[model samples]
Structures are given as C-alpha cells and as structure tokens.
Target: MTAKQDAQLTGVPSAAMTSLLPGPLVDDAWLAEHLDDPRLVVLDATALLPSPRHDGDHRSASGRPGWAERHLPGSRHADLTSDFSDPGAPCHFAVPTPEALSAALARLGVGEGSEVVAYDTGGGIWAARLWWMLRAISVPAAVLDGGLAAWQAAGRPLASGDTHPEPAVTPAVPVLRPRLWSGIEAVAAISRGEHPGVLVCALPPGGYDGSAPTRYSRRGHIPGSRSLPGRGLLDDTGRLLPRAELAARVGAVLGTADSPVVLYCGGGISAAGTALALTVLGRRDVSVYDGSLEEWSGDPARPLETGG
Candidate 1:
C-alpha cells in the first residue's frame, strides 16, 4: 500500500503536529498557565448585548471599545459583528464566506498552525461563537471556560489599548467541514417534516415561547422546535456544567432521537454555545442554522409556533 493509504489507516497524522488546542473548553487557570505560549493567539470576542425589553427589537454594539479599554494581557479584540460576519448579508451576524473567513483570520495573526483561545466579558456565549467558527474549519481552538469575569475573579492581569499583532506569516486556509452549517432551505424542510432531525432553539426560554421581545418583526420559534437555551447549558460561574449533568439536560430535551441536531438562535450567536456543549459531549451530528430566526422570520410566509 502507498504511504498515503497507510497513513489513512490510522487517524493520526504522519507528520509532526502543526497545531494543538486544549479541547473546546478551558478554564481561566489553563489560560493563565499558558499565557505566554508563542503559538497561542487569544481573542476577546465580546458583543455588548442590549438589556431585555418588553417592547421591541434590541440593539447590540460592538465590544471593541470595551475590549480596547481592557482585555486579557496578551489578547486582542475580534469584532464578531463586522470582521467576522458577512457585511453584504441583510440579516445581521451572517456567517462569512470562506475567503472572508481566511482574510479575517490572516489579519488577526491566525495561521493554519495557530492555536486559539476565545473569551468574552459577560459570558462565554460570544466566545463560543468564535470557537465554533474555528472548529468548523478544523482550526484548533478553545473557549475560555468562564470568560473575562473569571479571569478577573482569579486576579489575572489585564491590558488596555490596541494590541493587534502583525499579519500572520502564513495566512489561514479554510478547509470547510461537512454538515457544520445548514441553510434556509434545509431548515424549512425540517419545519415541514420533509427532513428528519432535531430543531433546537438555543435562545432564552422567552424566545422559545414567543413572549420575549425580538429584534425580528415577529417573535416565537420555528414550528416543531425544542427549547435548549444556551444560557442554561452554563453554570453560575459561566463554566459548562459537569459532563453527566450536561448529558442529562441535553438527552432529556433530545429524548432518544439519534437524528442530527440543528441549532439556531435569534441571529446565530448564542446557538454556538449549544453547539459547543454538544461537542463537549462527544456529538458530531450537529449543524447550526446560519440564517436562524433572523432569516426565518424575515419571510412572512414561513410558519411559527407560540408557547413551548
């Protein structure tokens, strides 16, 4: 057999390792310990969310200003609203194309061989979004377990001002993985029972029940979806729950269905938390609805359901 065939027999690579990550989740202690690793590129992917309102769609702001004011000592800001999203897409936070993804990573000093750690100020929701993006492309990355608050609580040092590094010597080449993302058509199919899988809404319970205010014109979840709020997946400390506890919660909602899971949120940001949680539980049959409620609600013809 050829060398390629022989190498393929085992999942291990024949060459020396090019990149490494501490899995999809890492606590503040792990980050503090490896703060100085040359191959590590830490990012603050915080997005300032608007306070909950009883009336209408809430506005969100880029967390760059806050990130610029203070961030992890060696970290830089990753503007998820602009740089990491598709500017031309009508819906906000639209996933970027492979080229845009590559350019953004390259500009951020992330090469094919780079290891990444992502965190946010409020919770790890925003950080989980970035981690999901990197993982979808097979880039080694992890979400800081408890985020900036945890780091600060642990008395870690922080820095202010611009810390943007030089462009990566080797630009990132996105190798898109299969079934990591699902489009509107597939989601619509699922809603119509033309498809077989689980539709999980990862927003707060309000979003699932249609009682919550929404940025989109209409509130409520897509038809036949189950609630699995991403916020519920985390503990009071913002770290993930124990694996057994997590599995129990997830399994309870999923309920013995071996079908693939399709996760979605108001825009698309919070769903990553559920995706990350599922990944931590050793699930690979998952996909994120890129359009999510933004796109689904944009079209009035689509049906929605009120209440859980």
Candidate 2:
C-alpha cells in the first residue's frame, strides 16, 4: 500500500498525517480508508434537532430510524438522545454521568486504543455532541467533517439495518473533567457578571434576539451572553469553513485564545459544534453549558433577555 493509504489505515506518520492527525475533524476520505481498522470505532451519532414549529418533547427526536435504513458500512449507530444523554434530566440533552456514559460506550465496542470517529446525517451538530462527550471523558475521538452527507457524496458504499460488534471488555473509566462543561449555577453566576468569562449563545440570530419560535418557557437568551450562532461556522456543504475564516469569526467575539468561553444554545447540541470550532482554532479554554437554554429558560428564576 502507498504511504498515504497506510497512514489512513493505521494513523501512521505520512505527509497527509500532518493535516489529519492532532485535530478534532477528519474528512470522509480518511474515514472511508480506515473504516475496517480494528483499532477504530466509527459511530453514526445521528440525532435530529426538533423543529421549533413542532411543539413536542425535543428529547424524543432521534435519528435511529433513519440510521437503521442506511449508514456507513460496519458503522454502529450511537443514539445520542437515549444512550448517551440523561433521559431523566429536567431538560433535553443533559450530560449523563460518567459511569452511564462509559457503560453505554463500552456496549458499542469502544475501549482503550480505539480511535473513535463520530458522524451524523446532517451537519456535524449531533456528531460533535458525541465527540464532546468522549472528550469530557478523555477519550481520543474526532468528528467526520461534512459528516455522512460528504461520505455519500463521495460515492461510498452504505449498509442498512443493525450491526453489533462484541461488547468491549475493558471498562471505560471517565476521568471526570469538570472544566469541560458548565452547569446551571455556573451559568447563572456568569450571567450575573460575577464570573470572568464570555457567555456565547450558539443559536441563530432569531433565537438569540428572541424573534424565533421557541419550546422553552422563555424565548430569549441568557442576559449577558453574546451571539455567535454555531451554524455560521459551517459552509454550504455542512463542512467547517477554512481555518483562517473560522479563526476570524470566533476571534471577533473571543478576542484572545486565553479568553474563557462558555458556549450554549437551545440545548447543548449546537453548542458542541461551536466548541469543536474553537478547538479547531487551537483554543483550549472553552466549555459547553450542558443544559443550555433548555434548563435556563424553563426555570422561572433564571434571567433571560431578548433583542441584540
């Protein structure tokens, strides 16, 4: 095999490794070549966000049915809504306990030395959520840039129905990185201007400006947060923008790499997209508010404001 192909399969050093490795995003070509690597676990972490017009439980919206119909060959579906998140939490997309997360991942055949590649049918919003979950537990993971859309566009083969590998024997013990996530109390303090950091709302201008339809009790954003919609980071094909462009967009609000950034959206899903964007820009001091506006706006006590 050529050196490039070898690198793709084993992550061995090659000219292309410079751009592919030491990062959080990989393209469809890289994943396709490595699809059969024993040390790799490719997860279709597909979860559709509920439409604002549909007033129902957002937690019930899942991409499993679609995944069951078609997905990457040999890729197992990782249900973010049910398997990876806290279903009993007060709001949608709450982070599950490390133990719960570890067990769920183990059942998906993930273990030590496994290089995880997560992707979704849509833009990488849901896939990034799973990447963040793995990162929170200190696992080595990356999101498929452009996701399944790009894969299919590349004329890759697809497999349908369920495919289960043996459950992993090694337990996934999470290191419990508290700094990777922010809770409601921490967000409240940040909103109150008692904390030293920037609160970023990753929803669209409408949600941030209070002009959009909302499922939350309140229709606006956290009082002191700034608007930096996560979708703005992606291009027409659902792939992230060029590095220079991405840096410019995030830098406008973040100012410096040292700036502590707390990202949030309708729920935690999109915020993870922004978090992944920041990581791509080499910013380490970033955290996603897990409950996001779901818990914030639903509570009568939390403060929210509308308009830019």
Candidate 3:
C-alpha cells in the first residue's frame, strides 16, 4: 500500500467557524433556531446503501430523490458517497484528495468560515461520515442527532425541491489531519497487537458474527476487534444516546485503558457513526479505518475472526 492507501481522508486547515456549534453533535431544537444564519450550511448527506441484489444504496438508490421529496427547509444535498468519494479507488466511498474535497465543498457552497451541519435519513451514519471527513481536514462541522427523523418528529417544517447555492467566493484548500485517519497499515498493526490501542468494529451483530451478508468479499471482522455496531449508539428515535449513557456504552469496552482507538466497519461508513459517539463522549484520539473490512477482508492473508 502507498501513502494514499494509508490515509484517504483530507480536509482544509481549521478555519474559524462564523457560527460555532455547541459541539460535534446538535439537536433539532438548536438547528431550528439557526436556519437563517448565512454562515450556516445544512447538508442532507443521506446516502442510502442497501443490498447489492436490490436497488439499495450501494447500487442504485440515492438520497437525492428522498431529499427532493422532503428535506430541511434550506438544506442542500452533499453526496458523500459519490461527489466526495474517489471514484477511481478500489473500495466504495473512498475519500478524495484534498484538492478534490475542497472542490466538492466549494460546490456545496462551503467557503471559509462556513459552519456545516450534516444529517441523514437512513440513520446518522451517513451524516457522521460527512462529519468525519470534514474534521479529518480541520473543517468545522457537526452531525444532526437522530438525523431527518428527529427533525420530522420535532414537528419541524420541511421543503421539497433542490437547492443550488452559488459557489463559495474562495474556498480554502484543506490540510489533512493524519491522526484522524488510519490507513490499512494502522488497522493491521493494531489487529496484530504490535500497535497500542483498541480495534473497535462498528458493524451490526450479524456482520461482526459472520451471520449476516456482507458487501465485501469476506465475512467476519478484523482480528481482536470488539463489537459495537454503529446503529447501537443511537436510541429508538435516531438521536444519539444521552451523554452519560453514551459514556457507559463506550466505557464498557474502553474501561480505564485510555488508549488510542481505531474504528472500522464495512467500507468505513457506519464506523463514523460510532466515532461521532466517541467524540461526543470526549475521546479525541478516535480514528476511523479508512478502508475498513472492505480493504482488510480483500486480502486473505490479513486474517479474520467470527462469532460472539
């Protein structure tokens, strides 16, 4: 693997956010009040990845149509799975170069001083994916807790039709934050126990246990990873669990270990949702495995483990 293979994610240098969010995660109540802020850019980064056999997210379905049917009043579609991905990469949803990402952000009207709030309908994973991508390059961004469902449940108004905001005047190029991204090398080292830190698998139970279908060529998870499905971090309404409860969920696995944590899942999507949860819990050392199982499992020599 080359340098690019190690850390696929990149972003602009940390620019001041005109409208600072309370934290990395925000609720519908807060967003409702800030809808009119010119510096605030809300993106429905909802990319649906269903099964390969069906017209699911990974294959044909797109969140654009759903965004068309109904979305936040001033929100635009930030196509994380496509527009922001490196189409030439071997795996799915590959993070593009800094130049590519800066261009994409410009297209989304995210210029310097912009505050991004990403939300998704399929769950917070897609939104979290966007958040992780931006934060990796020092962009000021956050995920909408519970996503579109929470927005609707709060009786917030929605609008149909597309939003084509004019390009940002001068979008700054992002600098990659290497620590936030773990390439295949880091994951393998951690898996082999040569590297310090825990390997956390954020996929569902079936995926972790090798009992469910996978998008990758192999089944099961990386060796020595603990099961913490991304969806498990969210409550029934799609909002993240309360802070104290969230601490308990993560603490159960982390304990007093205070070590670096590398998170991964199929194609690095859902793992981000878990990363968001950890960030909410104040763990800045968290990094998502960029390639995740899609890359790891591709090489049979890498090794895998199954069962609870």
Better of 1 and 2 by TM-score: 1
Q: Per-residue lDDT for 58-149 in model 3, tens only?
A: 46346898898999988999887678888899888988887788778878888777878999998899999989988877677888988889
Model 2: runs farther than 4 Å from truth? 1-22, 54-59
Residue 91 Cα positional deviation in candidate 3, in Å, after optimal superposition: 0.5
lDDT of 1 by residue, 125-213 (tens): 89988887877776678888889889989998989987676765566777776478988889888888999988999989888898878
Show the lowest summed lDDT stretch of 10 residues, model 3. 5-14
Model 3 spans > 4 angstroms off = 1-19, 51-60
For candidate 1, the TM-score is 0.92
Best by TM-score: 1
Q: Supply the TM-score for candidate 3.
A: 0.91
lDDT of 2 by residue, 224-289 (tens): 899999999999999999999998898897776465889999889889999989887767678999
lDDT of 3: 0.82
TM-score of 2: 0.90
Clashes of each: 0, 0, 9
Q: Name the lDDT value of residue 249 in candidate 1.
A: 97
Q: Rank the candidates by lDDT, best first.
A: 1, 2, 3
